[model samples]
Each structure stands twice: as structure tokens, then as C-alpha cells.
Target: MKPVDSPERTKNRTRSGRRGGESTTRTDILTAARHLFGENGFTKTSMRSIATEAGVDVALVSYHFGSKRGLFTAVMEVPGDPISRVTAAASGPRSDLGRRLITTFTSIWENDDMGVALQAMLRSAVNDDGAAKAFGDFASGEMMPALAKTAGLSQETVRAIGSCVFGLALMRYLIRAESFTSLTVDELVDQFGPKIQAIVDQGR
Candidate 1:
């Protein structure tokens, strides 16, 4: 006959199993959310569908992310906060701020995985009002104000500067325009940095 297991051993085993399962569950949900969000855009992808794709209970998605918007936020978070990175690039010598911003922005797009994720966010923003609003609010409310404070520029002026940078990124990454896409990051920076600088310098 086999000896009975101790209560403490059984409890430890159960706790370990739960911890492992929780981590796997969260990862699976995020993976499913990213795939669905990319394929169907934010408006169309439902929590139930993501759960189905992840082979998880729908409640798990709710438990993990709270809601679809929360899940999207999680998906979009990069290693270094993109907004903070941009703000940092915009800070310091006003003379070189434009070049710094362009270089930093382009480097982010050149990051293979991050570029794909950002592209998805942009695509969803185009066709979904909610997504568009969220993106706009982030730019206008968070990034614009931070950049304006850093560059010592008026909010409106900073907004225009942001528009130019985002437009360049949109054309190059999302539209995949032949002319824009063909240029190397350095070349694009060389070509557009001055234009951005012009906008930025006006405020100084």
C-alpha cells in the first residue's frame, strides 16, 4: 500500500499548479487578443471570440484584462513607453529637437514586432471611431502636452509638429507608399527632419 501524502505537500503542489496555469492563461489570452485585434480590428473582435481562440473561459479574459479596451491597452504597451520616449527625444536643445524626434520615431517603427503592433493599432484607428478617439486622445492629451512643455512651444504648435511626424510614419509604415517605404530610416530622417524642424523652430 502507498503511504498517504502530507497535507502540506498537497497544498504546495496545488499552489504551484495554480501559479503555472495562471501565467499560461494570461499569455494565451494576450496572444489571442493580439491576433484577433490585428485581423478583425478593435470594433469587430469580441471577448467571447478571443476566449474561444485562446481556449480559455470567457471569464478569464474579464478577470485578466477587465474589458476589451484594457486588453487593447495591454497589447499596445511597448517595452519603453512610446510616449515617454518621444517626450524624452523632444526634450533638450531646441535646435536639435526635430532630428532627435524623427530619429527616435523611426527607430521605433523599425523595431520588427513593435512596428507590427503599431500598424495594427493604426489600422484599427482608421475604421473604428472608438479606436480613433483613443489614439487621438493619447496624442492630443498625453503626448502633445508633454512635448509642448519639453520644447517650450505652444500646444497648437506642438500638435502640428506631431501631425507631421505621425503623417510621415503613417505613409511609410501603414500606407507602405513605395517612395516612403523605399527610403532607409536615415534617408527619411534626412528628408523630413528639416520639415519637422521648420515647424518646431517657428515656436522658438
Candidate 2:
């Protein structure tokens, strides 16, 4: 007869599997949320739909994210926290602020899988008042203040800089304008860096 497995070994194996599966389950929910939100926009996509897409019970979605708004916030938060990244980049030497900001922003879009979710949020903001308000509030309340504090600029100036950078990214990546898309990241940065720097200089 085969030897019986030890109770302690079985217990440890069960705990490990449970921990691993919980992480996997959370990841699945997030992946499903991103895809659905990207395709359907915020108003059209429901928590139940996300649950269905993730193949988890609807209650689990609530357990993980609290609500749809909470989930949307989590989705919009790119890995490494885009706001913190920008603040850190701006915290460097004042002379290099433009180059740093542009370089960091471009690198983020190029390296991360956030483009789709960003596009979705932009689209939703355009069409939905609620989404527009939420997006604007987040930018004004959270991002602009942090960036302005670090960069030593007025919130208005930082907001304008953010708009310019966002427009560039939208044209280059989301809209895929041929001319913008054709340029390398360095080339685009070189071209835009002066304009951004000019704005940063004004804040001094």
C-alpha cells in the first residue's frame, strides 16, 4: 500500500494552495475589469459583468473592490503610481524638469500595459458627465497638487503642463497619428521638451 501523507504536510500544502489561489483570483478580477472597462466604458460596464468576465461570483467583486467606483479608481492607477512617478521626476534639478517629465511620461506609456485602460477612461470622460467629473476631480485634487508641490509651480501651470503631455500621448499612442507615432520617444521628447520647459520656467 502507498504510504499515507502526513497531516502536517497536508495542512501546509492546503494553506499554500489557498494563498496562491487567492492572489490568482484577485488578479483575474482585475484583468477582467480592465478589459471590460476598456471595451465598454465606465457607465456601460457593471460589476456583475466584470464578475462574469472574471468567472468569479459577483459578491467576490464587491469583496475585492468595495464598489464599481473603487474598482475604477484602482484600474486608473497605473502600476508604480503615475502621480508619484511624476512628483519624483519633478523633484530632481529644476533645469531638467521638462526633460525628466517628458522622459518619464513617455517611458511609462511605452513600458506599461495602461494604455488601453487610459484610453477607456478618456473615452468615458468625453461621453459621460459623471466620469468626466471623477477624472477631473482626481487630476485637480490629487495629481496637480502633488506635481505642483514637487515642481515648485502653481497648480494652474502644472495642470497646463499635464494637459500638454496628455495631449501628446493621446495623439501618439491612442489616436495613433502617423506623424506623431513615427517619431521615437527621444525624438518626441526633444521636440516637446523645450515647450514644456518654457512652461516650467514660467512658474519660477
Best candidate (score: lDDT): 1
Q: Write out the backbone clash pairs for model 1.
A: none
- Tens-place lDDT per residue, model 1, 1-204, is 998989999988877752357878998988888777666666667899999999888999999988776776786654446657877897789888778888888888889988777788788778876567656765666678788887788987887887888888789888889989999988988988888888888864
lDDT of 2 by residue, 28-51 (tens): 888888777666566677899999
* lDDT at residue 111 of model 1 (Cα atoms): 90
Which one wins on TM-score? Answer: 1
Indicate the TM-score of model 1.
0.65
Alpha carbon deviation, residue 7, candidate 1 (Å)? 19
Cα lDDT computed for each candidate against the true fold: 0.79, 0.78
In terms of lDDT, model 1 sits at 0.79
* TM-score for each of the candidates: 0.65, 0.63
Q: For model 1, give the 10-residue run with minimal summed lDDT.
A: 75-84
